[model samples]
Target: MSPVVLFDAALALGVLGCAALALTLRDRTGTVAAFMLTGLLVALSWLRLGAPDVALAEAAIGAGLTGALFLRGARRLGPLRARPPAPAQAAAAALGAAVLSAALLWAFATAPAESLYPPRVAAALEDSGVSNPVTAVLLNFRAWDTLLEIAVLVVALLLVMTLSPPRVIPDKLGALVQPFARIVVPVAVLVAGHLLWQGAEAPGGAFQAGAVLAGAGLALVLGGVRVDRRVLRRALTALALAGLAVFTLAALASQAVTGALLGYPDGQAKAWIIAIEGALTLSIAATLCLLFTGYGRRSAR
Candidate 1:
């Protein structure tokens, strides 16, 4: 077989094996570890599909953040996580999975070869503001979808705030962790900014930038860095709202200037998109970090 086909076959086997192991693993922590492996394999599948943006998202939110969350929960739950599911529950789950897989296979097998949106997007690219087709689609062509996605993040943060947020790190690794974070967080920030800038012309964008910033935040949190609780709460709330506020105001401003909402002025699409994405990246990062912080039982709350 060709190298590409051989590689794909290996990746497919790895993904399937990991997924099955994740489902059958008895220990909660081991299950989470297997699931993380599956997520990484799925991310590689996205890369193979030639979708770097989707791959980045899969790596960041899917594999990275999810693994961290599961690890945290596993640490807390300990032996309770290993409790076996009811036999009926396990059987039902298996049946559901089988049915869903069959349905998806049937859909794809019967579907047409062509898509309806790509041609339209290509035709409209020149006037869509950003040079990158993905960026233009997100921040210009289908801006309402982007706006709603940010709003969903805002809603998630608000929901998470119903519980106490982090007051301190769960377990401080060591003095070495602080120095390590000092080295890594700055680089993460620089990379995030670069991704934001590159999004206008490449596969990077606000989501990827936000995910990098969230990783930095997670590292700092786990490294025992924290602000006053009140300050942390207010700052997180503001950051969580930043994207929505900026995006909504921008939409209004656009509507006032143009005849439609989110419509950038002629030839000024790049500038507008950059400004919106800058705000969005910070908001998404903070929101994601907050979700992690509020996930489990709080200490001394």
Candidate 2:
């Protein structure tokens, strides 16, 4: 068999295994784990298809960040006990899922290869000054998508905040974790910075970098590194709005200079994109950290 055929078979098997595991898992946490695994496999498939940008996004946002969110949600919901589904309901659900999946597969398989937006995207790429076409699409040609995605993130954070239970005091950690966390957090932040900066020309970006930083912050919280409530709250709010605020301001300013929102006039496109991405990275990190920590007063050491 050809290598391509072997690879395709392996990918298909992996995806099927994940789907089966996800369906059979009784525990919510286990199901989420399966889902994340599925996402990782899908990302690998994307890479095989020669779409590294999509693969990066799938691995980072689809698998990593989303898995984190699901795990956090499961933790908040507490112990999971699976209730046996009624046979009829289970059958109905299975049928529906099968039908939907088949329809989707058929549609995709039959769809034309031609794209209406590619020419426009290609034309804008040179002027956008972004090497990656995906980046150019998100930040330039169709910036509205990026702007809306930011709004969605803000809404998600707000929803999490609203639904969160009242403050629960955290357990006092013994001395061992604090020193380790202190050292690790700074290193993680440094890594996140590198990822964010390199995103312009690489696979890492604001979302991925932010998630890495947030993961670091989450470690600190879990390890009982002290955080003042007032400080944390203020920081969370600011970071939550930072991306939207920066993007909005940039758009408004661009209107006057370029006669188009988010259109950078002259050669300042790269600078503008970097500035927005930096702020977005910070905001995303803060929001994810806060979401993981839940609503709580952090003890000030």
The C-alpha lDDT values of all candidates are 0.87, 0.79
Who wins the TM-score comparison? 1
RMSD of every candidate to native, in Å, equals 2.4, 3.2
Q: Estimate each model's TM-score.
A: 0.91, 0.86
Instruction: State the RMSD for candidate 2.
Output: 3.2
Candidate 1 matches the true fold with a TM-score of 0.91
lDDT digits (tens) for residues 50-106 of candidate 1 = 998888888988999988888877766665435677999999999998999999999
Clashes of each: 0, 0
Candidate 2 local accuracy as lDDT?
0.79
* Displacement of the residue 160 alpha carbon in candidate 1, Å: 0.9
* Total clashing pairs in model 1: 0
Least well predicted 10-residue stretch by lDDT in candidate 1: 163-172
In the range 1-301, model 2's lDDT, one tens digit per residue, is 9998998999989988997897687688898899899999999998888888678767866887778767766766776666888999999999999999999999999998887887887886778867677777777777778888988888887886787644434467788778988788899899889887777776677777887787787777768656686787788878788888888888899998889888888788888888888898888888777665566443222
